[model samples]
Target chain A: MDKFLCGIDLGGTKINTVIITNKGEMVSSYTLPTLAHEGPEKVIQRMKETVYKVLEDAKLDVSDLEGIGVASPGPLDAKKGIVLNPPNLPGWIDITLAKILEDEFKIPVKLQNDANCAALAEYYFGAGNRTKNFVYITISTGIGGGAIIDGKLYDGANSNAAEFGHASINFDGEKCQCGSYGCFEMYASGTALANFAAKEIEKGRESVIKDIAKDGKITAKDVFEAYKMGDNLAKELIEREAFYLGVGIANIIMNYNPEVIALGGGVANGFDILYPIMIKTVEERCYKASFEGCKIVKAKLGQNSGAIGAAVLNIVFSKN
Target chain B: MDKFLCGIDLGGTKINTVIITNKGEMVSSYTLPTLAHEGPEKVIQRMKETVYKVLEDAKLDVSDLEGIGVASPGPLDAKKGIVLNPPNLPGWIDITLAKILEDEFKIPVKLQNDANCAALAEYYFGAGNRTKNFVYITISTGIGGGAIIDGKLYDGANSNAAEFGHASINFDGEKCQCGSYGCFEMYASGTALANFAAKEIEKGRESVIKDIAKDGKITAKDVFEAYKMGDNLAKELIEREAFYLGVGIANIIMNYNPEVIALGGGVANGFDILYPIMIKTVEERCYKASFEGCKIVKAKLGQNSGAIGAAVLNIVFSKN
Candidate 1:
């Protein structure tokens, strides 16, 4: 059938809506702040407004579309289409997100976690390119990942599978917020890089990281900026970040043995600088077969990946 | 479809052969010493002898069987039906074990790694019992595992996907034989447990572990024997073993998110003793969503698991 698909990427800070043809061509898209501090009801209302706006911009009515897909922060049940309490979205306790949207739009709605959506998006339209076994890892404030196994996204026993960040690299190193010890995120996430720099600075190690950070706490961005200016501390921290990232990647290689590992999120901005050392480190740690079979690349889809992935959910699931 | 199945479990020390019904009832079985030092050609000859013996014992000819399955130590190509150089099997380099068997028996034959075979056996006839997503972990001298995903055995990119032993738990800890730093096997294998005990004893924390071992090297068995005698050092070493095993298991849970994790091999013989501490540590390290969903249980098939798994390979893969 010739029709459009609607998608909503419901993030902590922004609500993005898009309308795309069945083949994934963009028709209309809209974005607005989530204003999460205002709570759930208003956020839900604004999400509806964006959907209507996208439909109007595309010059089509609801009858012209198949259904809507919502990608949200998880701990949510993709099967039940309920939003459990996600730390990112306050007051979303067991909310029937898909049902609400289905009732409001009078069409079917599907929901999935944001990370899985990005993975599905990359597999279909970006770096992954339909590889039967593909993994997408995002390394921003925290690390997150999704595995597309046998050409479909794996959601695990719960909707919370592929929590790669929580997998420990140091079992006795430090306690993590998730009640685990020495999580991969604790050693390799962008937040970890920044935190390491801050602690070293607090101990009075002199570096331009402080000057770039100004009066605020040192951020990974500040460290990256310092690395551009020949700051020794920044160089050291980034090198360690690359090494740590390689360790985490090797672990993923051991587990999934995927054909491609597409990197995304903020820290991946330094992909060029990180590639050489990161590849060397992964080579040292992983087996020859899995490592040789896998390609480590940067993700192709940009900021709109979530929207594209959500839109494709109905398409992919219908095919499944 | 009603024909019997034949299985051969080829190991470092012994070769076990079995004939079973398609539904998994054992008909006849036999075991013979492998004498691996006698090299590949002789080992292959002996393996054929045992298969004939088992068939004779069951009063059935090869023509009466559906197919034969060979389970061997890996680093081999299961798809190609070739046995590569496994450290445990001397002088075996790209030997076409399956082709040889197929020619000898004039029947279809399947070859899979030992760990994967055990996982298949468990999923079909034992503890796993048709669980869609299941993992089988065997912690012996070394740790090895196999995964069953979506009700099918997951043969990853190179048939080496579930090499969990090599996934590091300590990035800066010990260098493993696989050339990776701080592998889970280095910290938690039964060999590791005994090595940890031996090191502590060498530093002179007096215990009956030394007495139990006599002139022999301190082994995981010796440690358990001393634990039975209320030896403090043995107790401490076992406690550490439980903790490290838990850490490795938590990592598996993070990656696979399977519904069941069946523990097998020598270390699992002490499952009752290790259960309390191991469960506590896993609970402490893993996320509740997965932890609550998974059951860590002892394998049901005992030593015959290998033979049973190999026997069922044709039954399972034929359906796939």
Candidate 2:
């Protein structure tokens, strides 16, 4: 009998669960709305249901599973597998999802921050497999990052190592939610793009984004659409965001000299639109020799990266 | 018979050579004027003389030496042991110092950037021995840096991995010699401090630094002395420098999450004066959990760090 593992990508809006073979090929999968506002117990119940559904779909018994791995938004305690008030899932203070899953399934469980999971997936299956050192950055509702050094995840002293978003790009640029000024995320995240678009609309800068958002609630998608329609204001806004993103990414490159930099998350969907400009700015700014030929590539696995990464964690940990 | 190594720390003004056991116990040492203006051949001859003197003082023959390591300023090629147009050593372009030394003594020789050697010395004998990942920064006329990962030096794609000095702290703040703006070295180096002091003096700010530098050749040492005597302008200058330094260092910590940060070089001599303020700024700026318990320590071995690190390169390369 092939050993199997269950993986969960726990997001604020949804729960995605998968059953995979030891090689990390997904055998079956299930998805459900998180209904996180219903609180931790309800979310946990939904998560448990999804895991069982995935196993049943694969025609496997619970006894066939070797372990379960969870990837969640963090400010979490991975050692204890507790999610400590992740910003996206408000009121989720110290939810021990891993321990509860282990209890319900009678199997070992592992937990990691979602960004770290994405990095693991990229390391094993995406752009980073060719190098031992790299950084993975996900730009969406908020920016998140993870690092790989000498072929292992660098979790820092408290398992909070790769806070690349909080690396300040400007000392006095803008205020961040983390009570810092000029964080890279403050200027380059999807939220920042939306905010910039909304501010431009408020200033009566004529743009096609207004037509895309008839309700006047501008989003990053609206901005991208407007840019595609040749809206000068939207193009300028995206160019500014890409400039900051490029500078921030260049800073990471200069500091770490990673062999590759993997871009992931929702904003990466616009990678083709944004990457050329980002590369141009980085080339103009970063040290020439170190960054030359350093690959900047979009993440391959998309929505499944977190779940796949989580599944691989069991394999990685067992080998270690 | 015990195996021994030779180290040469070649500086613009001086040359220091030492003979030591493989265990790092110094057996004999000697120092002499570099006379770098005398050109490459004479400097190489002087370096050979210093090495011979140190060995003679220890009563050891060339046969006793396993190898030699030379540490010099770069843009040199470490792989081929060539010093390529280092700014301080004018006209010394593409000189293969390592090959020259090896030919004279019939022992293998290795070359490394001076800052990298200092980092290696710290890793082997100073604050860094306890951890495999760390960054060593030397704040002198110009800032220089090295990285230690997995208990070994990382030379990057072009042997320039640890250009910590060139990493941008502010993307648009000040112009740097490397054709970038707001590099960490532009704002935090000893050269930057002196430049700031001179600009302040030019603006007619009242400070004792002007009195100390009767010839108007202000230096970082003058700025420190004035601050020590409670000159308000000097205090403000130091504060600004510390803030930029903290920003840069915090960026490094956030990106690499190194276990320790070792400060070295001439400006590090005043670390006692700068420590409290530097730590305060770093704590306020960096991610709290990632930096907690991460040490900011003074580099041991002082002036000998480069030479000691150079000696160790023989062992490091041999193992590789």
In terms of DockQ, the best-performing candidate is: 1
Interface RMSD of each: 0.8, 1.9
> What's the TM-score of each model vs. the native?
0.97, 0.92
Candidate 2 residue lDDT tens string, B1-320: 76898999999989989887887889999999999899988999999999899989999998898899999987777988888788788779889888888889999999998999889888887878748777899999888888887677876655676677887777777777776678888889999999999998899888899998858899999999998899999999988887777887787777766889899988888888888778887887776666684789888889998999899888888986
Best by lDDT: 1
In model 1, the clashing pairs are none
Question: Ten residues in a row with the worst lDDT in model 2 chain B?
Answer: B154-163
Instruction: Please give, for residues B240-283, the per-residue lDDT of candidate 1 as tens digits.
Output: 88989899999999988889999998988888888888999999
Per-candidate interface DockQ score: 0.78, 0.55
- The segments of candidate 1 whose C-alpha lies over 4 angstroms from its true place after superposition are none
Per-residue lDDT of candidate 2, residues A144-234 (tens digit): 8887776777666555767888888787667667766688888889989999888878888888898898587888888898889999998
Leading candidate by TM-score: 1
In candidate 2 the C-alpha lDDT for residue A279 amounts to: 91
* Residue B67 alpha-carbon offset, candidate 1, angstroms: 1.8
